[model samples]
Target: MLIYLLKRLLMTILVIAVTSVIAFLLVHLSGDPAAAMAGEGASPADIASVRETFGFDRPIVFQYLEWVGRILSGELGRSYYLRMDVSDILADHLPVTATLGVMALSFALLLSIPLGVAAALRPNTVIDRVALWLAVAGQALPSFLFALGLMYLFGVYLRVLPISGGTTWAHFIMPSVALGYYATPAIMRLTRSGMMDVLQSDHVRTARAYGLSSWRVVIRHGLRHAIVPVVSLAAVQLGFMLGGSIIIESIFSLKGIGYLAWESIQRADIEVIQAILLVIATAYAVLTLLADLLNAALDPRIRIS
Candidate 1:
């Protein structure tokens, strides 16, 4: 187990290193950061001064090494637009993003699990068909469009929810629903399939033969077994949620890292961009690791192997 963990940790480190290099290079390749910051009307000397200040004058390799070194030394650099430390900006924004992610995940789980289990319990029935159709619709619709529709129906037409901005729990309802609804299909499908398989298992058959209550057989025996796969799906979805937040946050005008990243990109704020990507990659890597650990814990065969 220790060796497996160490191996995964090493792999995660390598992935982060590779991701950092790719992110840095991609941003640089898109345009000269210094030139972008200096603007079009700037004179030659102005460009040169800006380049020197930002160390864009250095060789790419040296620039990367310097950036990495500064990162190691706890300097994420200042945003070109905000003229403030990227770390400070991230510190302020992370809580909002985290809170939003947690709420959205909660909403997704609450919406998916019961519906999926019910579908599995009575396959080919009206309830199951309706759930499946809803799942299909969720999978088909894009999150931004879904959000807009919700805004129109709940916010504009009914005036029951705010269309944009985060001020209260009501403000979170639309965007969280948008994000959660988009993710529900995957969870629902995974749970339904897993539950069906678990229901047909020998253990479940034995439990039924032993006169266990239907709900007990389903919850105690089948639900427990189904959870492993559901958890794996949940972890993957959680990581995706972090990445997908950019669109939802932008649509809702939420004060989160995703919003910050979007604003940073508009101003060519490389520091914030790099910081956001690095943080998000790290989060994904960690979530994967946690999922592996959970899998091992749930299935002893994994630990044995």
Candidate 2:
């Protein structure tokens, strides 16, 4: 297990290294950062001043190495538009997105796992049909539309939840539901299928033959094996949530990294854009590594493989 973990960690570091290069080059490849930073109608002198000031006049490789050095030193550079330290901006906003991602994943797991287990236990019955229908609907529905519906229902009609801002937990409820619902279908389907396969395994049948209660057999023997894949999926989904929350954050007026990304793009803040991409990519790689370790813990076969 230790060896397996080390391999996964090394792979994650390599992935992050590749991602950093891509993030650094992406803005440079688009066009002159100095021109974007200087804005329209700027004179040639202004552009030159901007370029030289930010070291954009340096070789691309030199710039990249310097950027990496700053990142390693916990400096994310200054935003082209905001003129503030990128790291400071991220520190202020990262927690909101992180919290939202965690809440969204938690909601997905809490709702999907039970539904999947129930559906597996009662195949072809009404409970199974309802769960399947929900899964289908979740996948088919657009998240933005779902978010709007949630806002209208709870915020407008019921007036129980706030429609915007991230000041309180109530502000996150609709956004979390909207964001989490997109992931629910895949998780539910995987869980149901895994449970169905596990329930039919010889070990599960032997556990039943030992006169264990149905719930005990299902929860203990069945779910233990069935949930391995779900752990992997959850990690991937969480990374997606953290990176993909821009639209949700914008709609809900939440001050998170997602909203910050949107603002950076509109303003062509290259430094912030690069930082956001690198941060999100690093997060994704780290989550995947953790997932691999968790899967190895859950299923010894994975470590052996």
Candidate 3:
């Protein structure tokens, strides 16, 4: 187990390293950060001064090495547009995005797992069809559109929930639902398929023949085995939610990392954009590693594989 964990950790570190390089290069490739930082009306001298002050005139390799070194030294650089520490900006907004991601993932799992179990248990019945229809609709519907509908129904029409802001739990409900629903169909279908396969196994039949209660057999034995894949899927989905919350955050005025990314892009805040990309990529790699560890723990066979 320790060896497996070490291997996964190494892989994650490599992924983050690669992602950092890509993030840095991509931002640089977009345009001259120094030029962008200088106002359009500024003369060439101003751009050169900005470039020299920021070390942008240095070799790209040296700049990348210095950036990585600073990152290792717990510095994320200063934001060109905001005139604030990049790390401070992220710290202010990361919690909101993390909270939203957790809420969204929890909502997705809570809703999808039950529906998947029900659909699997009663395949081809009305219950199953309804669940399938819901899965389809979830996949087909755009999250922004769903967010709008939710805002109208709950915020505008019913006036029960707040339309925007991350100040309260109530404010996150619509955004969470809308962001999470898109992931529901994939999780639900995986659960349904996994459960169906598990149910058809000889162990399940033996458990049934042993006269165990149906629910107990299903939950204890069936779900325990079937949920291995779902755990992995949930981790990936959570990472995605964290990275992809820009649209939902924009719609609902939630000040999260995603919103910060949007703001940085508009202003060409290269440092912030690069930091955000690296952070998100690191998050994704870490989540995948956690999922692998969890799956290994749940099924020892995973450790061998």
Candidate 4:
């Protein structure tokens, strides 16, 4: 287990390093950062001065190295537009996004699991067909469209929940449901398939033959084993949640990292952009690693494979 963890950790670091390099090159290649910082109507001399001050005057390799050193030293650099430390900006906003992501996933599980289990238990029945149709619709609809529909029904018409804002629990309901519903179809399908497979297994039959109640046999002997894949998918879905937050946050006025990243891009704030890319990529790598570790822990054969 220790060796497996170490290997995963090393792989995570390598992936981050490679991502950093690619992000750095792409940012530089996009256009002149200093020119973007200077804004419209700035003279060429002003842009040159800005470039020199920001070290864009140096070779790209040296600039990347310096940026990496600052990261290692915990200096995330300043946002040219915000006039604030990049770290400070992230500190203020990441929690909102993280909370939204977790809440969204939780809402997704709360929805998909029961529906999935019901579908599996009564395959070819009305409940199963309804669940399948819902899954199909969820996968077919875009998240933004779903969010708009949710806002109209729940917030605009029903007035049961707030459409936007992250101030309270009520504020969270609509956005989480909208953002999470996009991933629900995949989760529901996985759970349904896994449950069906487990239900057909010998242990389940043995439990049934022993006169265990249908619910008990399904929940104890079937769902428990089926839940392992769900756990793994949850980690991957977290990455999806974070990445998808950019659009969702925009719709809901969520002042989170996703919105921050969008703001940084409009301003061509390379410092903030670089920081965001690294942080998000690192997050992806870490989540993937955690999923791998969890799978290995749950079933040791994962490590062997």
TM-score of each: 0.92, 0.97, 0.97, 0.92
In angstroms, the error of model 2 at 160 is 0.8
Relative to the true structure, how large is the alpha-carbon lDDT of every model?
Answer: 0.86, 0.92, 0.93, 0.89
Output the TM-score of candidate 4: 0.92
What order do you get sorting by TM-score, best first? 3, 2, 4, 1
RMSD to the hidden true structure, all candidates: 2.0, 1.3, 1.2, 2.0
Stretches > 4 Å off in candidate 2: none
Measured by lDDT, the strongest candidate is: 3
Sort by lDDT, top down from the best: 3, 2, 4, 1
Per-structure clash totals for the candidates: 0, 0, 0, 0
Error of 2 at 305 (Å): 7.3
Tens-place lDDT per residue, model 2, 68-113, is 9988998888986777999899998999999899999999999999
lDDT of predicted model 1: 0.86
TM-score of decoy 1: 0.92
Candidate achieving higher TM-score, 1 or 4: 4
lDDT of 2: 0.92
Q: Tell me how far candidate 1 lies from the true structure as C-alpha RMSD in angstroms.
A: 2.0
* CA lDDT, candidate 2, residue 29: 91
